[model samples]
Target chain A: MICLAAFIVFAILGIFSATHRRLAKQAFWCVLRRVTFKPCQASIGEILKGKIVGWLLRRKSRWAGWVHRYFEVFSWIFVIITLVSTFYTVKGAYFYIRYGTCNPEHPEQCLISTQAALEKGVINPYYCNDK
Target chain B: MVENSWKSQFPFLMQKKNGQPLIYFDNACMTPCPIPVLEAMEKYNKEFFSCGGRSNTHFGRDVDDKVEETRELVAKFIGAGASQEIIFTKNATEGINLVARGLNLHAGERVLVSDREHNSNLIVWQVLQKERGIELMILPSKSDETFDLAGLEAELQKGIKLVSVVYSSNLDGYTLPVEEIVKLARKYDAFVMLDGAQAVPHHAVNVKKLGVDFLAFSGHKMTAPSGIGVLYGRLAHLENLSSLLCGGHSVKDSRYNGFELEDIPARFEAGLQNYGGIIGLGEAIKFIKQVGFDFIAKQEFELNYFITRELKQIGGINFVGVDDPKSRGGIVNFYHEKMDSNQLTIFLDESANILTRSGRHCVHSWYNSRGVKDSIRISSYFYNTIDEAEKLISALKKILGLV
Candidate 1:
């Protein structure tokens, strides 16, 4: 449902603004109803879709049509992207704390953590995880 | 531009808003005030800002005079029997509430209302039906969405106590037949009141000639400020209606133990009233009289015809009420079968600064009954131009990808 994606977006936006905070609450309720197998009776999903497509319609009619027609599909894509992104972020944090490198498989990829090890005058930067 | 049009008079339309010209089509909600109305309010607020009816100073005297003159102007504007019949209210809803509480109907007494009433006209009666043990009857419209006079006759025959209905529907702009309704009520010896918020702005409503017992309309719906409204009643009826609020200015004389209520208008109006709003409304009425309703009506008809005709060419657009635009006053109410009304207007606003009202529009009862979730409502006033209508069409066309 578009409500889940809208909830994430509004929740992120809600941190800095009161208007988006109110909308985030509505999106929360809509997502709650949806997960409970009830309808998205709050109508916030349609409103969010309208806002997005309406903005697009100002610049490109074709994009407006595509998005308006399959907004639900796009919402699914956003949710999947969010879940994947969250999983990687949490994993990166855990690895950085455990082994002094965010990417233990390729220590050089994490310049900040690798640089910190190099600062201690290690002959090879892999020494941070190898030890 | 149409000759003798008041477009130049409204300061809001003089320039572009955010590099795009603004086209305001939401007159049913509230009309923008002209310069004269604004100036009159400014003059009052700056010059005679003193408390009216409380001091013997020149400022207080001017305020009192201005207030009385405005009352007389309102009485003449609506053709009431006398100025004593005009009671200044917060808005039309307060006027209707005053009547609902004032009438003091007993248990089993009946009040009939049309199905397409504004919430102001509907909810007050519903509260009464609950609290006072009165019977609230809903009169359904004809299949064509016009008022059913035969239905009224039947309901009157069934012994209705009062008939309160909207003079013109804010939902779709379909006007009720007030003459026949008044005749039926008079024949049945029942009181008739009109919620004139929509009617009084564009129509020449003469309540005395029409023999209506009570009428209510908002000043902001015309060209005035928001806080002022008029409630017109026959002097006899007003004498009988109870005051809804009582405090500082509502009483004639006060004692440690008791106080006497002031006469008529003062008896009902109970505070430091909206003097600025009243002055603005008076000036607005003056402007309306100078422009004339004939010109207002003609401008409205031309605009509605153009908008309705062009909107029809768009896909899946179904109109509310009659197909004819002229008969629907200044309102063009409809929804797109392919596009949600809320979405459609959002797109319109996104493309251009064009404005319109959408969603349930406060007639949830009618919409709920007809299974309509929403509608887009646009209205044209005298100041609204044919160019604005074309802009609206072009905006809609752009949204639909037809242009």
Candidate 2:
């Protein structure tokens, strides 16, 4: 399932690259490097110098290089987004377990937390349906 | 205005992710529980958090009463003759398995199913066939994905013991002709079981009116919480079917050598039940009643028509199933020539904040037969709006370069 999810993420990044080239390239590099920091240092030509890209380089190096450079920045952005989302999910689950809510300030948004608060007799304003 | 107002009833719809309003179009997967249903579950956990049907304590007794009341409501909702005919399981898969495994079938007996059945309905029968030496006949569908009634009748003539079919296709949302299928099965003296996991949420299904012997559905698909499902069977069939699980609540009396099983529903529901989910389902039924099927159906039809029309305007987009949108429920499965369906789904989710499902949708048999691997499925419920559909269209156009 994780592999399928990664494949889907990359595929979407590839498709979205059509309109948003720089963002997609940044996303691709960020994911390939597994980093959440600044992605300007890594060049697309270096990233695309893999076996398949190598074979393409042998025949159409200019085209392959162009494609790699185009998608470099956006790919890094996608990776950063994915990493941040994963971090937030883990944080949310932890909060939900400890405090019965994903967001401490907005406990009403989490049903688990809301139910827990209601059981404990804590007034949850978000779920207030007295009317 | 109707869309905006109805959408507000679900709190999850009010959520914003990445500065975009969440456009949830994956209702067929599982619906976001509305406030009423959530509150109903909260009430159970807060006030009567006790084991049901087994204790003599006041709390337990009260919980049991609420459970039975919910059972009665469910019975009335599905037009069952008595509440005892309703057995609550973990989910629709468990309900279907209870019926599939409990039914006493001899070797060489056949079970008929449609070509478009979900894995829950198909895999259970496949296991039964492998274990019991029963023949599992898969009836074919037409080019448009509608079941071939003539083909089903031919299979029925071969002396089928049971005919189990999905009431609606999860892949393309094509609804089966369950009434006609049940009538034909009756003529063949075969019992009919309808997997109502998808159907019950969208349609007002009455088991008695449909003349089906058994029906299975999940609460999560109908604005209720997960881990609660219903298996509705005829009283006579319930009496004859064996209990799939045996434990504390299922037995009437047990001796050193022999044990007497309890009657109907309790005999089937063996372990401690999901009281919170069951109570929430009762509330879901109430909410559905308040909304009314007329409103639900009208809203779904309009959303489906609008989406299909918009999709048709986009080039390189092909929809699965019949040409008429009304024939299917509020689901649209389409593929793009320019991009993978999985990729398109992710783009919709990440870029557009619109959620949709993609893949074979647990109906790999249909895909395997057609040699088609995957497609994108957009399922709309009553809460979905025209604006959401427009967002989806706009996203698809941008992703596929149709803009």
Candidate 3:
């Protein structure tokens, strides 16, 4: 539980920092244009050249829409995997509480309903053959 | 007082073998001691060298008190009922032999043992069965060189007198299901004796909670001096058993006609005791406790993972035991058809400055049974680092390629 809470807090802090950097970059570009008293920053040819090189080298393709769609699909898959693993760890911990550990001999003892053993002063609810 | 590093404890470990620093990975055979254990033994040898409980003199009484204090420390460490239950022997082998010799095994009775047992645990029973006209029932092991629970249960269903097993296989650091074994022994009315040479140092071994009748382990494996280890028997069993060795301190009154015996522990501990070694063992355990078992387990587990991953990359190096740290401890065993284990060890030592144990590891019968002629073993302790493991892996790969 504590680990989950810590992860959430760190995630929020990371997103906040990323947004702050993006906003700062936009503000700086606007200030530079105003200081130079110019409506436009660069020639279309120069901009197109840089974009083409970046797109081919870094962004992979000129079809920006499909690239963004692929990234979004992969990002969602990554998030799902992370969330599933988090749940798996939580499940393991819960089972550890229910049955002491994952002793193969007593797999049934790892269930949550084995809490009655705790009342009976049997702290190791996980030992499948505790009886 | 708080010596945290391995070099500080076992300075010899840091000494260069060739041009490289000695990377000792044979912990299953014996561990290098820390400074505190050495100092404790030094104090005993230099200042307080007296036979315990033999004389009423000042030195004798002081030595007696120190011996008892050491006993108390060992007893508490294992969670034994009392200091009286803990018997100081030469080593775990002698301790197990004591039980084999002392326990009353009838001619028709059976002694149960697992397939994964070290020869120390196996051969003693075999010798007893041959000498004393008892039957030795060998329990089958699983495919992974581990005790088969179901097969063990089938064996336990029989009328067995004693169940002698290893808590962890020195061959591969595979831990047995101790709690389950103890429970089954209870059902069959058998006394369980654990060869805990591999388990005690790396993990938390609470004898009372584990509820075994007798437990034996060597001090050398736990960073103590050799020839001074323990045999922890329940007080009832200790009182009931016969002493195999008899001499000074064991008898109450000796005459030309007859002799009367003293109380247990002392009765079992005959001759002039290993005063220096016992005191050193006590200090070694104290040193381990100070660092903490949990920390030790965690460090060794990480090392085990690194070793497994690295070794897996090398082809034909078959690792024994359940590769997970949660199930196993810090011992890794591997064998290759290309080279002999001893040859591998020699190359690793001469070329790479890595110290590894090879061959049967005192469990000859176990190796023979599985058709494994020899195997290279790398057992780690908390003091071992990932870098040392890498060195060992590289050496092994080099040796493997050569063969």
Candidate 4:
């Protein structure tokens, strides 16, 4: 039910956004611009020379942008990974619920031994994977 | 797919190696592909790669159309009354397995099989006998590997329920009289299944006129890609049998308590099928139609006669079956006086780059029945020339001299 809701929402948004070309282009460009590398405040000399060796040297810390970049990359990766995993889980669950087995092709026939089916109780009759 | 002549269809066969044009004599095992099959597969993979019948979208409908188009082509090729009678399977192995498992054979019910069957037919029955308590009865073969009709009739008199036989012997290249066998089996109410893995490519098969209960054939052996096969069941027989595999797509409606299965073909297909392979297989059949079966059979017979004449000169080599072209299709299986088939195959590969099927050709029981271990099989296609047969005979002599 949740997947269906999300799919419907996304499909409608996709249709609406496809028609609004300027807004769609602006949104895509914003993401592209955000991911692109920016000029760093840290000078080459300061990067090469450590603070302990050159106490007289003064430079601004680029710690804020560096931290932001790390968080952005990590979050983007996390979102993509989460979405992919959710899809797999949904597919697996769908087949399991529909046929009472992961493999729909040989449902009536036992791919596994009868003993394994008795022990696992509908979990993976073919293999004794840890429940 | 647009139809083209054989000369225009497969230019690959005309390709030359070492200033000599190649000759392909390996059709009984696998045939060379024509351009239409490759193009169809490529077009589907690029344009219609989606789940068919599962999703209600343009791409999904495209996939469904492609799959059904192939099914119709295959049905027409075999003279099936309706496309719904044809079920797409992975290969001849899976197609046979589908029948083996789907039909519930009891402990006392008998399955009569010939000794000349390929392992695809033999081992499946054996597995069923071992697992399901079904009894398997073996029918004897003639010295030339032809079906012993009297022996089969004697067995039939004993009240057998099913008789599965090969339409053509891949080991010895003899074409069985399937129409006679079918008529005989029908008299006793015994179902007949024909393994057309060898015969379908070389000749025309009218399933309706043949009046067999089922016919199984693979695509790869007939210029299509591998991983695709057809299981043609009479619609009435399929209606009586229960499918072992059942899933969402195979069902019409469900109330969480009971479900109704779909019609013949849909009820049999329980998962995502090989859509591209089926589409390509359809085009392959179209290509074969353009070449004309009469021309194909004549070319194969001429080549078979030429090979038999050449091999007869190489004395001490024994061909297992009758050497008459009228009796066989294109396969010619023989063994030398004192040469291991594997060793000879290796020698041919190394010396002449000739490809031939060695060992029992997946029909171990056939060899076991003859009290022999294995034989070398040189099967030919229409594309093969008389010169290649001579070259193969020359290579056999060289290998035999070493023995």
Q: What is the lDDT of residue B261 in candidate 2?
A: 90
TM-score on B-chain, cand. 4: 0.93
Give residue A77's error in model 4 in angstroms. 60
Give TM per candidate.
Answer: 0.89, 0.77, 0.73, 0.71
User: Against the hidden true structure, what lDDT does model 1 obtain?
Assistant: 0.86
Q: What is the DockQ of each candidate?
A: 0.34, 0.02, 0.00, 0.01
Model 3 agreement with the true structure over A1-131: per-residue lDDT tens digits: 11222233344455678864544444345345545775322222122222332243222434432432254354345546767866776676665564554322344554543444434443444445646
The docking category that best describes candidate 1 is acceptable
TM-score of chain B of each: 0.98, 0.97, 0.96, 0.93
How much is A55 displaced in model 4, in angstroms?
76
Separate clash counts for every candidate:
0, 24, 3, 0
Error of 2 at B67 (Å): 0.7
Candidate 4 lDDT, tens digit per residue, B46-78?
987888878788989998988888899898999
- The best candidate in terms of TM-score: 1
- In candidate 3, which residue pairs get closer than 3 Å at backbone N, Cα or C atoms, i.e. clash? A99-A126, A100-A126, B9-B34
**Which residue runs does candidate 2 get wrong by more than 4 Å?**
A1-131, B1-4
Top-scoring candidate (DockQ): 1
Q: In model 4, which runs have C-alpha deviations exceeding 4 angstroms? A: A1-131, B1-22, B254-258
Where model 1 places Cα greater than 4 Å from the true spot, the runs are A1-3, A33-48, A83-131, B1-5, B15-18, B401-403
- lDDT leader: 1
Instruction: Assess candidate 3 and give its TM-score to the true structure.
Output: 0.73
Q: Decide which is better by DockQ, 2 or 3.
A: 2
Poorest stretch of ten by lDDT in candidate 2 chain A: A40-49
Tens-digit lDDT track for model 1 on A43-121? 7887777678767766777888888778879989988887787688778888778667777666667775666643443
